[model samples]
Target: MDQDLNVVRGDSPDWRPPNKLLGQYLLSRLKLHGDRIIQAYPQYNETVTAAVVAERAVRYAATLQSLGVGCGDRVVVCCGIHPHYSSLLLGTICCGAACATLNNKFDSGDLRRLMEIIQPKVVFSMSDAVPQLQPALSQLATIPKLIVLDDEDTWKWFINNKIAYHEPQGIDPYTNVAAIMCSSGTSGLPKAVQITQANLFTSLMAFKHKDAYVQADDIVVITSPLFWVTALLYSLASMDHGVLLVLEFGASEEHVLGVIQQQKATVLFTASNFALSIAKQPSLNSYDFSRLRIVIATGTAMAMDTQILVENFFGASVVQLYGMTEILIATGMTRKGQRILGSVGLLVPTMKLKIVDPNTGISQGCGKVGELLFKGPQVSPGYLNNPEATAATFDAEGWVHSGDIGYADSDGNIFVTGRIKDIMKYRGHHVSPIELESILLSHPEVLEAAVIGVPHPTDVEHPRAYVVLKPGASVTADSLAELVASQVAEHKWLHGGVCFVNSLPKSPTGKIIRSELRYLTES
Candidate 1:
């Protein structure tokens, strides 16, 4: 037996840790902005005040407690963008249990796979998503208590049985899991990234220091699903900043623009492609977006020209954010008037970024492209129950070896070229899929584009493009090939040719599925 392994050392240096849990922090916001309307849903024509939200969250937590949920239990939220998502998530965390979010877009098979992994204690599904979830829930060995968010009977049961609000005592914020958000499954199946309470608080603090920091009385709108880590961060940021958050489930371009005009939303958070959609929508001029001061594009990289177009049209500053589930909001651009093309902006506060050779472990100097390694308090502890992946991705010093390839200039502006796995090799020359995709997006006729390397006879590999054109827009493949060739080197040119598709496959967060494109090109 390894008796010495369990030995405890003498008193060691103790550092300051976040004193509050994720739910407690958000609950405090209610006291600060009790009278203000903190959440508005234009779709339902409903508005909820901060005080009301706090009360609802407490009651919801009591309901979970009454149902025998306690510390370390997993509560899965399987629904679309509902107004009650914030309350449910806060309630789950308030009970000292972790909240796992699942998108309603998942089918029965997908749900079954994820359910087998998470093994949640309770599952909260909106009335609309219950049908889709039933099959998966039935197949589980032990059925979790199902609570439908929109059902009147469920609400009555929770409200009648609700107890007094009780703050979880002796909870360690650093070790307590806060939420389990799924990674973008671009290369493979999505892994459950376990974010701790400390990580969530640190992420909030980092965004608090940025130029796009949420302001008091600000009306913020997020277009992405609550399941996405970025959108969840925005939700928490809104509460931390005492801002009114407006949400519309399955928001279309028209719905988003209309909500902004009607609500006079001051800040917008959305996927880069959604922002581009708003800019390209023919009815954009019909909506008034003058109240918008800051717009953040996340999920995927936005073409510099597309950023300019959105900024010009909305009369708001557009900044691109580079982050993932593993490390939430690591880097973001916040320049108000000036625009930096192809830059994700300066490193976020309390974070350190280093570039190192992917093959060799040697560090790369500034302005050199290599894999980005990030060390920060906001980084996730690791993927859940996946020690092999955890060991491969995280290091002894707590640095997350991000598989992204990028570089920082002398001015400290970060430029993400592409993912290390997404880089295309042509005759031994490296080609950035992002570079080709960005150029293709700049074309007037192209609506969406994805680039991947395909097998070649002469060169070891060749660049291929899958494109989606604007409605009623016309452009030949050869012309598109010439357009890219003029911008990049010969080796990086589109030698594998272009395929026009109705739509490019995308992850839930709107990142293009490059692996799927590669599969299509090869097979």
Candidate 2:
């Protein structure tokens, strides 16, 4: 490891804070103040403290063990925006079993497909989601056990009569799978990504060194759902850091600002869109954000203009992070490093990053745009049960192909251009959609935009744009086309014209589904 990136182990005589495994570190916090409120949900007026969370975790683990969930067993956790869901994930980790967090928005078809692929032994789903999953219940023949998160009466009966609550037994963290989160499925179907205990612990350690913003006294607000890796990892990192977590079921600008003021939140983890929404809120200026120290924006790329707005509004720089479900988070731009407009900052302490040519597979020098590759303890072992996809993603040397096109500057700052598969080929010339999208988004009227390649009758391909205009703003297709033509080269211009849409289709993680856009055009 580089001298600057060296971390102190827990056993070392000179060891500092944040050295233990994520589970153990969380347990220590729980032991310290079991009654101190850890998470609060305003919509339902629900709250959980360290002591209550610990007891529930222990009871849930005992319930899982009694239901035949042992070490190595896969437990599918379909959680919504609730603190209990997070507690259950921690409980599953303590029981030495893998927990797969399924997206609650997935309908019956999506659930059935994932169920067939993962073949989980047991499923823990919220009551609201259980109704949607009812159609696929028969398809999940492999899942012999099911635990509904709602039905308080049932949960009470289980705790009171079904089985006696017992403390979680000792677990070997190194050999267990802490959590399993799926890829965004932007280009294709989603793949299950196995996040082991080591992966979670390593990621938390890296977050401490790379972000290093969370503190014990900080109140961290989490608005993203627990199904995504960013939210799950943030929760774990906060727990490990012994910080108070304020969980929100959904993003409500009013509710968020209220919680920040009432709870005195010091840190926040959310998407760039959500951050932009918060910044755009006129009411935000009235509230005092003096306690807010750090705000992490992930799931989508952060535009420079949006970053500036957030910094100016909150008096805190937005920490931009580039990550995926497959590798968790490998690169992040600290609040201090946001001076470089589009850079994603340096690689994490325990991670290694490289940009390689797509055709040659050879490492590219700085400033050369190519496919980004990463290798670290936080990298997933492989896709669950998809050997072909796993083999295709991981090289012989264990580097995970990120499929993202980016370049590093001389100062070691990383800049993501676009996805390898999303790049457009116009008459044999390669074009990055992100470059076009960024230029279009710079327009005062254009709120969000996506660029896709459409088949041309004469040449290789042509650029097409699907744009969502800012509220109350009016712009014709000709004006939008003229806007791009004036800024970009003739070859890079949108020859296929702009298509107006009410809203662009996006994945659950907030990435634009360009493939779907192309499909819509062709159909």
Candidate 3:
């Protein structure tokens, strides 16, 4: 196992799975920790226990059953961070239906396109989301039945008019789809990722791997959107592992940090951009983060210096979980110098990893960078109904071709260099923007940075940078360019030039929208 084989067979302790549907497992956990306080929404001023959430789920399931909904049906949920979100998620599972997230973050146009792709039998909408969903629903050829969750009369009836029911038995874990998530990695339109029962089951357990695991009584401050995987995991973990989940409506730095301090949260699950926003907040020093134990960062490559600063600020180690919305690629914890600083730890023990040259089909050896492809039960089966995308991404051999550019050392430590399309071509050399961006982020005054390939007549394209500086810090573009020039090769220097911007464009989820930056260069 230690011969530096390019193909590493994932191995870890006690990964044997329990034979039950994800729904059944969820139901059991709900009963097991019925009295535990599982959810908190500071904005809503609500603190709910497992028992109350489960009752709502049971009623929601009963309502579904009365409406003839059952296994193999689709339910489009746009509840948008409400108190009923957990119950709706659990209720769909309890009824053997797959829930697709198209929360309020999406506009009417987004809903129109997604609804066409999903074609669900039922639309679960809260009052807050009706404005978006209704317009889209009206234009559909066969409009799905819209069920508003916040309708007081409907909820009162659903709660009072009890239909005695039990969870459907005999779910084939491997084939049955659990949930459909809409993912748009860095740019382009969104695609629906189909997560099977087995995939979700394996993902949950993979998070519990010994290197980094969540225990009972741990308060997890969730900053990700409810549709995103981190939010789903933390919500479910509240029931399964007896952890306390602190929830939030998306995108407000003050409220999120205050929740962490008020709740005395121990674990933080977030993306690199959101984490940086927290780091840049003027009021950050006022808060007491002494209770924070682990900061789990994902979505992009975290710069080493920024990682160190975040670690020192929170007084906790930053554990990077590298994967797209499609799958969780790799994660491991730190012990002194046991982990490489910039590396995204080892491949998840339940999955197998191999770096493959994108141009050729050949496997890459240790320390050779290539496109990473992984295989495991946790890996998604494919995109729902989008056969072309599914075929292009997931191969016949079960390897999910990750478009990410990365390499693995002999220790199986994965280092994500950049994305396939993002690598800039300069003077016949491949220049990684992530590599340059990482170096740019290391500067003390740089609040945020994004790198792109600005077109050049002779050299295919040249690397350009857009930077946001901290308030009152006046570091010039030349010093920043020199910083990158000293660290990387001459060709990888910011040849197109550096532009100091007031702020960088970001998605609602806080991911840098590189397309917008590229647009700025053209404009």
Candidate 4:
């Protein structure tokens, strides 16, 4: 236990915010812009106005009420690339029912487990996704009524049909659940995080009133699907700020460039992997990104070289955010504190953070690496139907153990090295995969890289590199292995050797699945 308490509080700590429901807040703010374009999706050739979202919310809420969905009830949404996705989610919340969004890419097994946990009363699945989720829905003890969002008949009969319904009364925004987003962790099955109305409202307010500023005219281009928590956070913030949102689904690199040039998008928000991949495209340098001012990177930490490329290419401030499904705003680059390279920036106004020694149960000091713990107004209450997981991670004192290994510098810039579980133990020497991965990513030939611990007979585990080369790159494996070996200590060397793959397995969030890489080594 160090005498110095390594706790950091935001300059403007969170206070008791207004007791407003998330749906009401969104609709109220979004409708003010009226004719301003709220959302644009190329897949449907759709452009939605603020007025449409507000109107649809009221109508959809009535329909949900008619279908027997009341306060405290749950609804599941598996709509893929649906332009009205935001409206539907808002409607579910406005109608006094919490909603859970499923990643459309999730296998049937993952979908079934989440369905069992949420126990939703109704599911709004995309027409194509229904077949995949139908098997899981059938296995549920209490099957939820499935509503296909794309079907014209269902859309009319279920959503636009109901007109008469009253606002939910006696609702407590602070305690009542509003949204349950599944957390895609690095090494385990996803857990459904229960977010209250207050959590969502407070988080959006934090961005609105405090640090991250969004202009009314900013066309925020979002490539990640709406199901992702990070995407939802950005989407809600953009809407609340009355910024135009441009949503792209499975866009080609050339198509993305065309969107940026045509729309003159001001803010580009997506995962680091996606950003990095596009930054490497030769055509990207040709685009006139004069309007792009902010590039927000999520999912994985951006390597220095890749970050620099994005900043140079877009002429934008690269904001790499460190947030999770549990806490909507943990740390992010703010107006007060611009990001330090390789750091996740300072804690936002809504959060208070502490770094604690995991094994010793003692608080660490500045510049000392330890597991990070967080407590805040926007932090989720707990996991849905998973009290054991809730108890294990969230302490009685209200600190949620982040399980991340990191330290803060003198200026309070937090750099996340890697997860505690992801640290490779090579003959009692602790090695960070992120440390090695960064070195590999610096190489010109490497497009992307993931380091994982391979089982070693004599040593505990050896660090191995799984790399994806750039198109037409011809670097040998030994050259890349020697690159790491020359820079790091012997213990951190790539003893398990290096292997090049077309691509590394990744979570829907764009985080590399090292556990899957370990399986690759075994097989």
**Inter-residue clash pairs, candidate 4:** none
Query: Which candidate model has the greater TM-score, 2 or 3?
Result: 3
lDDT of each: 0.78, 0.73, 0.79, 0.80
Give lDDT: candidate 1, residue 16: 46
| TM-score of candidate 4 to 2 decimals | 0.94
- Compute each candidate's TM-score over C-alphas: 0.92, 0.89, 0.95, 0.94
Off by over 4 Å in 3: 1-5, 185-187, 281-283, 333-338
Considering only N, C-alpha and C atoms within 3 Å, which residue pairs clash in candidate 1? none
Off by over 4 Å in 1: 1-18, 139-141, 184-186, 333-339
Angstrom error at residue 485, model 3: 1.6
* RMSD vs true structure, all candidates: 5.8, 3.9, 2.1, 2.2
Model 2 Cα shift for residue 436 (angstroms): 2.2
lDDT for 258 (candidate 3): 81
RMSD of model 4, in Å? 2.2
Q: What is the lDDT of residue 387 in candidate 2?
A: 81
Per-residue lDDT over 1-523 for candidate 2, one digit per residue giving the tens place of the 0 to 100 score = 1223221111111223355545557778787875777677776688777787777776777777787777777788786776677677777776778888899889888888778777777787778888777777677665456667677876665444445544345555565677888774334577888888877877776645534556677788877777888778877765565567787746567778778888888887777767765775545678877898878777666656657767677887677777878788877734454446766666665677777899999777767788888877778888888887888888888888888888877666777887888888887789888768767766667767889888887767899999888677788888888888887888889998998888888766566767789899989
- If ranked by lDDT, best first, what sequence of candidates would result? 4, 3, 1, 2
Q: Which ten residues in a row have the lowest lDDT in candidate 1?
A: 1-10
Deviating ranges (above 4 Å) for candidate 2: 1-22, 159-172, 184-187, 252-255, 277-290, 313-315, 333-339
How do the residues 226-260 of candidate 1 rate in per-residue lDDT, one tens digit apiece? 78887678667766777788876476788788899
